[model samples]
Target: MTFTFTVLIYMGEMWKGGPDTVGTLHKLTIKAEPGSVVTCRSAVTIWCEGTMNAEICVLHKEESQKTWGTQTPEMPENKAKFSIPSVTQEHGGQYHCYCYSSAGWSERSDTLEIVVTGIYYKKPHLTALPSPVISPGGNITLKCISWVGYDKLILTKEDQKFLSSMNSQYIHSIRQYQAYFFIASMTQDHIGTFQCYGYYNDTPQLWSVPSDHLKIYISGLSKKPSLLTHQGHILDPGKSLTLQCCSDINYDRFLLYKVGEDNLTEHGNQQTKTGFSLSNFTLDSVSSSTGGQYRCYGAYNLSSEWSASSDPLDILIAGQLPFSPSLSMKPNSTVHSGDNVTLLCQSTNKVDTFILSKEGAAQQPQQLKSKFQVWDFQAEFSMSAVTTALSGTYRCYGSWDSSLYLLTQASDPVELTVSGEVTLHDYKTLHSTAPHLENQDHTLENLIRMGMAVMILIVIGILIFEGWWSQRQDKKSTSHRVPEHGK
Candidate 1:
């Protein structure tokens, strides 16, 4: 009755039980970042006279009410075990277990607290300190931000991480201006959203929203201009054409800087388009000076930046205008005052236009590109009907280049003499050149007398014939009477 068996005891969470011994616990605690998961395997050994039920401490959720592990029986008389499922910081709290011993339930063991720690990724934000403008090529600065507590952060653009700031972050927070990110002269090269992140415990920070975009602007003038034809096509001087100045800029200035001239030969911006281009100039008249350089410039939309010239233009002006235009009669022979004649204009200069007028006409000059088909592109002012007054010095004016440059001087005056070839005054058109129809008049009385002499001779022949017939009739009658006597 006094004899008892002794079992060697192991240190650390191993307990020997007796009729008076109380249950004790070895609390295992864990710490990690929030949202981090931890798996804990707990084992307990109890030495008791009879089998007893035991449970690994219930994992109390620091936030939610839930147990981390299940209960187990000490079936091997002194061995018991339990396990904790995936755990989170929300499950962080005091945890303990109890033994269902025959000598009444043993007291709860020491608390097992878990501290979950791990880095978390949080959404980051990006903002521009000053409002930015976006142009083709522009400069920009942005503030990359992460959570306040996440001191260490990494910033990146596109996929390339900002290497220098990976370990440390300059802009700690937005409220306090400490550091900011900037791109030197932004271009198509720097066009993209930037992201950022920081090292955290379980609450891993994320990249902030991309910063506002920056715009670039530029301006340019045509050194060797590209000519833009409106109504027609690329034109040289003398040929009529409209010009336009294009740019990748706001339409606001589209009309303002409409058209301009090149500086090669002409004073800049002095052409018709420059002054009359509906937007500001019109090329009704073009010159060699109008052919060289052109430019279009203006501010960008709501930005300080400007757009460069759309495209350069090159224009060639036609050669000098027709030289002295002179008038002359057609058909080299003498033109009688009554004969119709056409006055031809010959040009010393290149011909683009021809003007026909009487000496005192103030009418507008007539354009003559194809008005009349004379030898080598020309027209004639004709005297449809000839008149002494219509014979005044005949002259003509011709020009080329829509702007009608120097015209040919008037031709020498043709002194015409008037003559009466035959006076059929009633049928004569003194000033007309239409085909002439003539009436021949001979003296009727003289011709009639000559016919009377021939008629008298014919009467004498008729009398002689009548006398011979009378004699033959008398002889026939006498012969008939003699035949009757013989009967």
Candidate 2:
């Protein structure tokens, strides 16, 4: 059966700035990443080299402005980097650097102009060079990719300003824009979420949308800690769970890290015996957000170092339902185009909403409230005049208001087989029975295969159109040009 699906868009929001300084100009140099053009909602890095006794301060100035504003963190070092997470149109401007030492403030360095590009365009793509995880003292790289033409690309770590640089392999292909950042000697401080952005070469202030987030996980420690959950990794709502961290070697403190979260929960001053120490953090009532991967670390008070992280534990909250919901089709037989169909989602527990999802669709599940009240909660989704797209394997989920966006465990899948001609698999013979595939269900698998075929065709069409457009533009430009009298 043929099938088509709509695309689903996730909701979110974004925004832009410049610089001034006074004092003699120093012989310092300031550098900008991705060749000075960037996109909004993308990260950008400005760096300056410094002396041992001098405190480096990054300064920025807007176009046609004399005064410069300072960006931090001003530290005494040999070099400094100032990063902007999500550069907006306002961030387009000229940037320079100055060094402040006991003698006095040094002169401003050569100013680098940053132009914003694709201010109203989509975000670029970001990916790790080799792998997401980095061992201590190892090197790693991140690459930013854009289809639209952009000159500059910026990389940021979490929300903190970080060092940014571009590699020689910038923009390897004309069909897409690309940049790379090589981070050498990774450490625990480098562990955080990262994102990239692109900017137009001419319009330094305007930025493109942000690339997808990339997280850097740091590893390599002396010994690994142990992670223990109060009961099991899975639990129901309103239940308590204690996550404990223990270390075999001597340690005074323990830390628990929730993957994707920025901060680590610390526990200290716990009682210990026989060179073993343990600390636990408890959740009084579990929620949807509480479910995720977690790891523990052991630390010593004497040294500011942490032991290797424990094996990650996957935690899941089953909502407040005692069991999963049930899903079924009304006809319970072979279906075809132009037929009317109803999908029933039933659960024993009361739920605020029921979501019906077709497997392998590029869209979010369709949600509906329980229209009819009954002992066994049931929600009916009616599809009038069904089309070929409506034939697929589907599942239902029960959810409550307290859980907000989280869904309970999924119900068993119901398959809707569609054929152009009717056969023995009609309602009379298959009534009261759920549709099943022979050994394996191809409803979802077929849909996915069809979707991939469509996507490939679209991509091929776009390449052909782009080649034709480029030639057409060249011809038009040649025709409009005026010949020089001398030539």
Candidate 3:
């Protein structure tokens, strides 16, 4: 590239200002990495001194040893700058500016040490502490990997600020220079490149270009997995409530879904979190139509993929078909006094015990004596003494081999009231209250039946007598006629 060398020049006598302070090298270093930019700077006071044809001067630049890797900035007149492109380790050599004038070249300036300082951290890379690429929804630890022995590390990402880190001295002593950078809860922000750097206290140097980029990633929730109820809750229509989906923070995004026979629909809101409780803060309000098993998920947000699922969680509300266990007596609502009554609690679930309880009774609830009855899918509780005190309210609670469903909250409450027995005076006073049976005309009907039987017997007796008289007359007449014929 053709460029003008613009520099300020002054002669000792001919110009107003004369003597220029000598040039001194301030900061000089040699450094470069594969496919990277290398730069050098210096502090050398230059002045013009030469014959008429061509004025002469010398330029100084930062250097570690005796070599020149980059050229200094353009100067106006006497000062001269020398530069070579793509300077490599082979470019190392002693260098200084020489002026070609009638007086010949000037004395050489002080030598600046030039030595390239790099390649210590061979193939710098990053690694997570736990071997697994994916994370579970809990606590975890991580480490930024580097070539053994490489120190002075700077961890950074494309759009994020750099976060400094250090390798353990113990690790270095054990040849484990790879630094461990801990994050309480692994999150999406941890994804990026981590590099190792070395200072240039001895060479033509600056920070070596960062080592090859290393990528950090967080796995999806499903990568770990969990189990949940298929039909979460049988929520009453229009009841105001919310469902929660949770996981660890290792994934980029999260999802909530309702698994169906044919398809899956979003059950609640989808949110993003950067902290440890990956799923603790994620939840959505419950809707009237929300029903079915739902589970949380950690999204990969990858170019060619889907989110991972977590261990499923099942929620079920009261009144669901496999009902939450409803307790009711044989004759619910109302029953005749002194009737043998049987109470039962039934559910489409497995239960270990069924508790029978009654309110408005003579005794305190828990202290009140109760019974636990068991059956295949239910329990039967019986009480023979039917009293007004016994007539308050009754309910049954079921328990699974494990887990408490807040028996009182999950089960329904039943109301019971008993009536007194009937009596003669009471019945006469409130005859209208009684439903009449067909026994009212029994005696009169019996009398009528007797009279009809007696009359029928008398008529049959008279008919037999008449028939005997007629037969006797006929026999006599026939006998008399036979006797006359014989005479």
Query: For model 1, how does the per-residue alpha-carbon lDDT over 1-487 read when each residue is reduced to its tens digit?
Result: 1111111121112232321243433223332322222222222221112224432222223333333443444455433444334434343344444444334345545444442222243444555433233345445565555545455454455434232243335443444322366656555545444554444433332222222322222332322222354533223345666555433222333321223311111112322433321123455577555544344444323433333443433333323343455566666325555566766666544566665545432222333463544445566655544545444433455555654433444445554443444333313453132343332222333455677887987898799889989999999999889977987
lDDT of 3 by residue, 1-487 (tens): 2122322232222123211332232212222232122322222222222212233433333332222322332343333334344345543333344232334323344443332324343544454444323353434344444444444544545443545546434254545455555656655655544444433334323344455544444445346423332222333334544444444445554444444321222222234454432433323454423534455555544521225656444333332224467777776656655555777777656666555556433232221222444644766777564544456766665544343222323457777766776433233323333347234345445766898999999999999999999999999889878867777
Give the alpha-carbon lDDT of every model: 0.41, 0.66, 0.44
Judged by whole-model lDDT over C-alpha atoms, candidate 1 comes out at 0.41
Q: Model 1 segments beyond 4 Å from truth?
A: 1-322, 332-334, 360-375, 404-406, 416-418, 421-487
Error of 2 at 81 (Å): 20
lDDT of 2 by residue, 1-487 (tens): 1111110010000001121334564566787765566654678877776544563353546444432434333444456677777776677777666655445556667878776655656687777755565567889888787776667777766644574634323445566777878889987677778877765556645556677777776655769888887565545667789988887776788877776554457789366766767888886688877877788877677655567778887665654455688898878646775577889998877778887878766444577887546577889998765655557888787778766356688788788876674322332223223355342334445666899999999999999999999999999987777565337
- The lowest-lDDT stretch of 10 consecutive residues in candidate 1 is 3-12
**Top-lDDT structure, candidate number:** 2
- At residue 264, candidate 3 shows an lDDT of 24
TM-score of 2: 0.38
My TM-score estimates for the predictions, one after another, are 0.21, 0.38, 0.26
Where model 2 places Cα greater than 4 Å from the true spot, the runs are 1-91, 95-108, 112-133, 137-153, 157-162, 165-201, 205-217, 258-269, 273-275, 301-305, 319-487
lDDT of 2: 0.66
